[model samples]
Structures are given as structure tokens and as C-alpha cells.
Target: MMTSKIIEYANNLIKLTDEEAEQLSNAFKEVNIKKRQFIVQPNFTAKNRYYVLKGTLMAYVVTDEGHNHTITFAIDDWWITDYNSYIFQQPATMFIVALEDTIVLQIDHEKEHDLKKSNHKFETFFRIMAERGLASHQRRIISNLTQSAEERYENYASKYPQIVQRVPQYALASYLGMTTEFLSRIRNKRVAKKS
Candidate 1:
């Protein structure tokens, strides 16, 4: 069961009553995703929110030209989903992919609503979670607009070291708005200088 982990994560972010926590756990199901697997994809609707229990994942969009741009990365204790698609019942514009063989706790929309109805605190939890997502999105936009490629890479390396190791260099390069060749050059420079 997800009782312990849910309580732990919820307590860190938002407090939940005992009964509310139980209900929240009941709504969750453990799921495993293989590396490079798509958890959510464009043109399809997302019905669940996933909390990373192990390993890492990325949510991204791919252009018609086959260029991919990653939008978000989730690691242990982090949540991911195409919220707009899940909440509005529309097609997803992004795809969420497992960066490594991973495990996640998933809660579908219906179960989430049922849990929300059981307590105001639970509803508040989701509201806060959404707000955090918005804030993260805004921060990413500002960084992309103002930071240099090297600066962005450094920011990610410091902030999400686990992601740096679990995700492919190509995917990380796309997210940083740099070509794989440039990213490789930077990585090589770092390694050579360290040695």
C-alpha cells in the first residue's frame, strides 16, 4: 500500500488528516514503466497523476520535424502528468517517458475526485500541488529565456543530479535547447578538466 509514502510526501508538502491519508492511499496503484516507455503521449488523454517512487521520467513534446523538446522531469517524490489533458478531458500535447526502468504510484481522475470529496484538506493538497506545477513551469520559461546553454546545464546538474545520470545526454541536450554535439563537448570538457 501507498499509505506510508503518501503520508510522507503529503506531510512534507501539505498536511492530511488520518482518514484523508487512508483514502488517498486507497486511490493509488503502483505501476512500473520500462526505460524509454511512454507514460503519456500526444493525441491521447491522460487519466492519471504519477508520483515517482523510483528512477526518473521526462515529459516532452515532439515537433512534426521529429525534434523533441522536454518540458519537465520527475524524480523520486515528484509528481507528473499532463494536467490540462487530464483535467479538461482533452488530447495531450505532450508525452511523458520513463528515463530508466521505474516505478510510480498512480491515481486516476475519478479516484482523485472521490478522495477530494472526503475532505477539504485533500482538495487543498491537490490545489497546492497544481500551484507548485505552475510555479515550476514559470521558472523553466524564465530560465530558458535568460540563461545560456552552459548555465542551464549547470542549473540542472546542481538541481537534479539524479536526472542527469538517468536521462540520456541527447534528451538532456534537447531540454537545454542545445544540440547533442554541443552537450557532448561540454560534458567532455568537464570530465577532462576534472581528470
Candidate 2:
């Protein structure tokens, strides 16, 4: 029997009947990814959907200057993917990598399409997920445009307290649009003030 906890979690975002949960459990595959593992690589069309069960993942876009710019980070209970490539069957420009040893539940494109077709609620669930992703991207753009590096760091610290310690300063610095030196200075300042 499936646990009610999993059922409740699924139901919160999408209505899943008992039979549907059983089908979903059968369709989904669980993976254990080591830190630095690539979830989605560039030039590949991402064919799988992943639901993070533990740890953190970073999505980044490599620039012409050869820098890998952090696009976003996904922690526990979040989803990570190269959205445009996954949805439209296009080549991926972004790379999704595990920032820590992680566990995830994955369903490939074929299985996901079948699951959505099998239930209207599943389609609605994915629609909501897409909307949420777009909103998050928009907020990131606004923050990058209007917020200072210190402010962005503070926002990230408050919003994702769990990730602050787990993620490296270099990755966090990229996310905050600041140099590692700047992040180091900020951390040093904070430490000195607290002492």
C-alpha cells in the first residue's frame, strides 16, 4: 500500500485517486544522483521530468565567454528541468546538475504524456507547475534588475535557509550576480559584525 503522506502531497497539487496513485507509482522511476552529476546536459533534448526528493540542484547556462552562469537552484521537494527543451523537444541550452547527493523521482516524456492523457487532473497539475515556473523566472529577472548583490544574498539566505550552508559560496555568488570575492567580503563583514 502507498503511504498517505505521499498521496496527500500529490493531492495538494493535483487530485489523484487511489488507482491513479498506483499507476503513478508504477510509471515513475527513482534515481540516486551523486553530487556534480548532470541531470540534463546541453545540446540534448531533456526527455524526463524530475521531482527532487532530497538535496539541491543547480541549473546553469554557459555563456560565450565560457562562464557557466547559475540560472536557478532547486532544493528538496522542488522540480528541476530545462523547461523549454523538455516541453518543446528542443535542444537544451541549460545544464541541470546536482549540487549535492540527491534523490529524485523521474518520469520520461512518453510516460508523462500517457499519464496526462490518462487523467485530466494530471494535465491541470502540470499546467499549474508551468505557471509556477514562469512566475519564479519572472521574479528572478526582477530581483537581478532591481536588487543589489547584498540584498539578493539576504533574500536568498532568508528564503532558502537550508541551502545557505549546503551550497558552496561560488555557486551562491553566481546566483546572486556577484563575484566570489564580493561574496567573501560580505560574509567576512557579517562575521565581524556578529563577533
lDDT of 1 at 1: 58
TM-score of each: 0.93, 0.92
Q: Which model scores highest in lDDT?
A: 1
In candidate 1, which residue ranges exceed 4 Å CA deviation?
Answer: none
Alpha-carbon RMSD, each predicted model: 1.5, 1.9
- What lDDT does the true structure give each of the candidates? 0.87, 0.84
**Tens-place lDDT digits, model 2, residues 49-168:** 888778889999988999878888888778888888988988999999998898888878888899889888778877888898899889989999999888888887888888888888
List, residue by residue over 20-112, the lDDT tens digit for candidate 1.
677778889999899989989989999999998887889999889998897878888999999889999789999998888989999998888
Residue pairs in clash, model 2? none
- Positional deviation of residue 49's Cα in model 1 after best superposition, in angstroms: 0.7
CA shift at 124, candidate 1, in angstroms?
A: 1.2
